[model samples]
Structures are given as structure tokens and as C-alpha cells.
Target: MKKTINAPKAPAAVGPYVHAVEANGLIFTSGQIGLIPETGELQNGIEAQTHQVFKNLQAVLEAAGSDLDHAVKTSVFIDDINDFAKVNEIYAEYFTGDTPARSCVEVAKLPKGALVEIEVIAVKKEA
Candidate 1:
């Protein structure tokens, strides 16, 4: 059976979708922007936004009984390709060891005019 996840510590979804869905042994997360959970305000700059994205991802993953360490894949969307290096720096801070397979692309825009957005697929932690 599949289960939907809505992390209380993560920012509320801007639209109708939930934060993630868990099926079998995996959790598939929706793309997370830089919105602060408490205020729903997008963070400033590529650096700050990137960090907030990871934080949001972490919250959602944890809600699904997973963490970044269990991530099998990730997809990143950014407003500017030139900010790849800056985003990578913050991304590295989150997945320091045994990083997951990732694909990043430059997009023209994001929800709430965010500089970055990230999504993940991860394995749920064993009980």
C-alpha cells in the first residue's frame, strides 16, 4: 500500500500535492523550494535558497522514515545555470558521504520565484 506524507516541519505545499508518497520501500518526494516552514517566505539568494531546499527535503524525508543518507536519487531545478557551483557547495554540505545519483537542470522559473528546488527518492529506514 502507498502512503502520503505531509511533514509538519516542512513548508506547506503551495498547491494540492502532498510532500511525498511512500510505496514499497521507497519514498518519492515532491520538489521542495526555499520557503521557510513557519513563514512560507522564500529564502534570499542562490546560497540561502539552496540551503533551505535541503532543509525542506530533510524534513520531508524524515517524515517518511528516511533521510538524505538513504536517498537513491535526486533532481535539482535552478533558475540560473551559473549558480550551479554555489548550489553544489550547499548540496555537498547535506550529502557529505556516498552521495546519491543527481540530475540538475536550469529552469526559467520556479514556484514563488525560488532560485532553487529539489526533489528526492529514498529508501525508508528499517524499523
Candidate 2:
């Protein structure tokens, strides 16, 4: 069975999709941008946006009963490839242990022209 995940502490979805979905002990997160949950504001700059993206991803993971440590893979999208190093620095602050495999690429654009976006796949911890 599959269950949709939504976090009240995270920004609402811009489209129809939920924050994440869980099925077969795995959580698949939708791409998260830098939107703030409280005001629905997009944070400014690559550094701030990257931090916010991870915060959004963390909320979705928590909603799905998973976390950064449980992540098996992730995909990061950035408006500029030049911001990769900065994003990496922020990413490391979150995925500090047993880091998940990841792919990051420069995209033509992002929703709201966000500087960075991230989506993750994580396994539920064994009971």
C-alpha cells in the first residue's frame, strides 16, 4: 500500500503532488524548494535557499517516518551549476552520517526560480 506524506511544518505543495509517498518500506519525496512554511516565502540567495531546501526535505522525511540518515538516494536540482559547491556545504550539514548517494545537475529553471531543489528516497527504519 502507498501513503501520501504531508508536513504541516513545511511549505504546501505548489502542484497536486504531496510532499512524499511511502510504499514498501520506502519513502519517495517530491522535489523541495526553498519555500518557507510559515509565510510561503522563497528564501533569498543560493546559500539561504540551499539551507531551506534541506529543511523542507527534512520535514517531508519526518512526515514519512524517515530521515536524512535513512536516505538511500537523492537528486538535487540547481539553477546554476556554479552554486554546487555552496550547496554541497549546506547538504553536508544535514546528511552528516552514512551519506546518501546523490545526483546534482543544473536545470534550466526551477519553480519560483528557486536556487536549489532536492528530492530524496529513504527507507523506513526497522521496528
Best by lDDT: 1
Give lDDT tens digits, candidate 2, residues 16-88. 8999999999999999999999999999899988888888888888888888889999999998999888999
Question: What digit string (tens of lDDT, one per residue) describes model 1 on residues 67-120?
Answer: 999999999999999999999988988997799999999999899999999999
Give each model's clash number: 0, 0
Q: Estimate each model's TM-score.
A: 0.98, 0.96
Model 2 misplaced stretches (Cα beyond 4 Å): none
Q: What is the lDDT of residue 48 in candidate 1?
A: 84
